[model samples]
Target: MNLFNPSKRVRNLYIKYGENPFVLLSKFIYAAHRQKWSKEEIERVISAAKKGNYIALIRILRSHTHIEE
Candidate 1:
């Protein structure tokens, strides 16, 4: 789950679904699982998604690249 790596699933999903909130949120959830994010972090992303904050969701996903063990 190296965040720096580009995920084929994500790319394929984007190709098929475009940049809709549901797709972005799904990507966030998937990345969060792979990255093993903290409960609070996952909650925050979920909250943003629930609120229809696509930008926030993208930001949160981007931030995942900086997460370290």
Candidate 2:
């Protein structure tokens, strides 16, 4: 996936949850847990998300999770 330019799936997610970081973050966390990600990996994503750039957070989550379009 292109990191610099958002893909169609990512754009769709932005449209759905752009204004709600909490909701997006929750989903990311849930997905991480469901995938049985390591604590370190989950913590890394959470720390990155804490930077308050939801777009980047979404991109990071997308890279880590398998979300259908």
Candidate 3:
């Protein structure tokens, strides 16, 4: 997983906000809602995000945005 190859939107958010975990987590939840991701998937991603796993964050965001789930 290339750090720069996942969700461009999320990467941009990180670049813009300097990787605030809470803010990114909030955005991930909001985006999951908007993207209609499953509750389980959202919860899983949220859990991972809350743990401060950037790789999980990127994977989940890419999965949501790119329909990889």
Candidate 4:
């Protein structure tokens, strides 16, 4: 399956956050269950994670957004 259609939460996170993991993660750890997540946020996260870099996620955490990861 393509990462865009990921099977797990992490992959979904990767798909949704893109290079800016902070947006979705800022609101939810894994947004698959929640209906609050916007498509823009999901797309951003997904795009960010697909880039295969965690620096953005780290940067987001640096802001103290209460990330569970």
Q: Which candidate should be chosen as best, given lDDT against the real structure?
A: 2
lDDT measured at residue 20 in model 4 versus the true structure, 0 to 100:
52
Model 4 lDDT tens row, 1-69: 222333223322332334354564544444433645456655655555446457655443233222245
Q: Rate the local accuracy (lDDT) of all candidates.
A: 0.51, 0.57, 0.52, 0.43
Top-scoring candidate (TM-score):
2
Each candidate structure's count of clashing pairs? 0, 0, 0, 14
- Report the lDDT of model 2 for residue 65: 50
Where is model 4 more than 4 Å wrong at Cα? 1-35, 53-69
Worst 10 residues of 2 by lDDT: 3-12
lDDT of 2 at 36: 68
Residue-level lDDT tens digits of model 2 in 1-69: 322234212222232446577777777666656666566766776776667577776666565454356
- Arrange candidates by lDDT, highest first: which order? 2, 3, 1, 4
From the highest TM-score down, the ranking of the candidates is 2, 3, 1, 4
Q: Candidate 3: misplaced stretches above 4 Å? A: 1-17, 52-69
